[model samples]
Target: MNKNKALFTLTLVFALLFVWTVAEAGSSKRRGTAGAMELLIPIGSRNLAMGGSDIAGVSGVEAGYWNPAGLSQINNRVEALFSYQRWIGDINTVYAGVVAQLGRIGSLGFNLSSLDFGEINVTTTDAPDGTGETYTPQYLTLGVTYSKEMTDRINFGATIKLISESIMRQSASGLAFDAGVQYSMMDEKLRLGIAVRNVGTNMRFDGPDLEIKVQPPGTEPGAAQRPFRVPLQEFELPAQVELGLAHDVVASESIVWTVSGSFLHNNFSFDEYKLGTEFVLNEMFAVRGGYVLAQDPDEDTFYSLSEDFIFGPSFGFGLNYPLNATTHLKLDYAYRMTKFFDSHQLFTLSLGF
Candidate 1:
């Protein structure tokens, strides 16, 4: 009877998500207008290599970013992960997360991610070429997550994130929320996940940089100028909804193979369909590959024929080593293909105890 109830709840949630996706299908028209775009950047080498298709099956500390519900599936009392990515345009991304399992209470996770834009020569209208000054931009996000297993086959989780961005004397900050659910069946070999992310208040920049001295209209040029502040418009976060499915094709003592797929509907960009597969051998080594296909809103088709999208295929591998009787260490690397710039490279280290 409990299993039946779980199934009913899952169906209801899926239906609601489908309606939301359809209702927001035209959101692509508003692409590139959202703020805090860093919230949409993918983190975690393992999932990025899988084209982020493992939302249904992702677990451990990394799941705090992908689908928080999966945090409840952590196998150890404590898990920690650190990841670094060489992003496009000479930007560097760093992420760190830790999760702790609390007996029957489930799991708690905290994560921080930041982007380094390096130093740029400060250029102004008068110094278009050289300002003899340099400044670094800061973009950071901090998240707190909680996940619990509602039943043997059902898991639920939520996260709250604080985002901060600053450049020169201007800065903006806001809060975002994320929630997800995962349901498993077929003896836990098949899984389904649904998540809503980046829902929050709008953000706008405010700082001394926006203040300027300007002469009032029709006033003498020598008249005392009035201080005027440039008004900045607030922008919404890039909200999105994701639905994912995964199934274990081969499950055994020595080998396991899983195939996964997901659909991501964006409120500020084109939709995406992701497909990926993973093969593990001896429970120690694994290889993964995946592809992403963007849906063109105008054509209503899945293809990136135009230059609007750059990311394509991705591949990666993982190595797991037992540190002791109850501890383990993992290393993962991923390479993603791109168009305009160098491909992205990511490395991650994880520990479980």
Candidate 2:
């Protein structure tokens, strides 16, 4: 098909999907009802510092999480990234991803993330203090992504992810899918991105831990007890649709300044708005800052009270150094403001070849 015709068809498809997903989005009434929240956690330090507002401009391996479509923008033939985050409640998160470009075809990426909750003492109804036993909870996700440049300015991508969670003897597993598209205009100075994330099957926990010994109410004194299995309810995964726009306000040889913003339509919680800015110097040093705000149901204003949100402003910096003619290394750090807990910190390292 012609370029214009293809763009028109892609836009129509995205609009239809947006309408269908938004129709199912839940308001405040459905908050806290979703399962496998680990899918919503942000990964790379650069994007996290931008409050996840760079969906349109993000590129390379790091784009696997923010917007898979951006993976098509990888400059090198191969890229690798690793990141570590100190999340709230003493939890630690580790993420790693790699992307490779295929000549005349597309880009492919793979990523893995895990959460460390540490060990906690086991407690039961009879033992209020502790049971002298400790168990660690495991949360993990693995994803495979494929992205391609449909036209000079249009890119499309999709990802399939496996989500797994285990606590003690009980465990749950499910699958999720993500898709996104990015369009560039104004001589590549303006960009727009749309994505749908974490839409998948419901998950329920089941294992030996759910079985218990019980007796019939009207049974005789010597009657034998029976093993009963507790029934569990399945929960839906958190789903959201994101729309973003980015523009290069100042583009020059030595300095480039870009501003980006996005709106999130959440299925299980309040909607959110994010704004971020990045300043690059000589293609080696960069600084970024961002702010996130949620919608308020009680008030008619555009944003809710800042105190009601868990995460607020964020800032970070990055350094890019060339290793050789065809290799480069990047180091990044980010800090985020939080309420009722220690602030979040992250470190990331990336290599391109």
Residue lDDT tens for model 1, 248-348? 99999999999999998888788899999999999899999999999977677776533778888999999999999889999999998988888989999
Pairs that collide, model 1: none
Judged by TM-score, which candidate is best?
2
Pick out the ten consecutive residues of candidate 1 with the lowest summed lDDT.
20-29
At residue 159, give the lDDT of candidate 2: 92
lDDT of every predicted structure (CA atoms)? 0.89, 0.89
| Location of the lowest summed lDDT over 10 successive residues in candidate 2 | 297-306
Please give me the total number of clashing residue pairs in predicted model 2: 0
Tens-digit per-residue lDDT, 86-185, candidate 2: 9989999999999999976999999999999999999989997889999999999999999999999999889999999999999999999998889999
**Alpha-carbon RMSD to native, per candidate:** 1.6, 1.4
Flag regions of model 1 displaced more than 4 Å. Answer: 1-18, 26-28
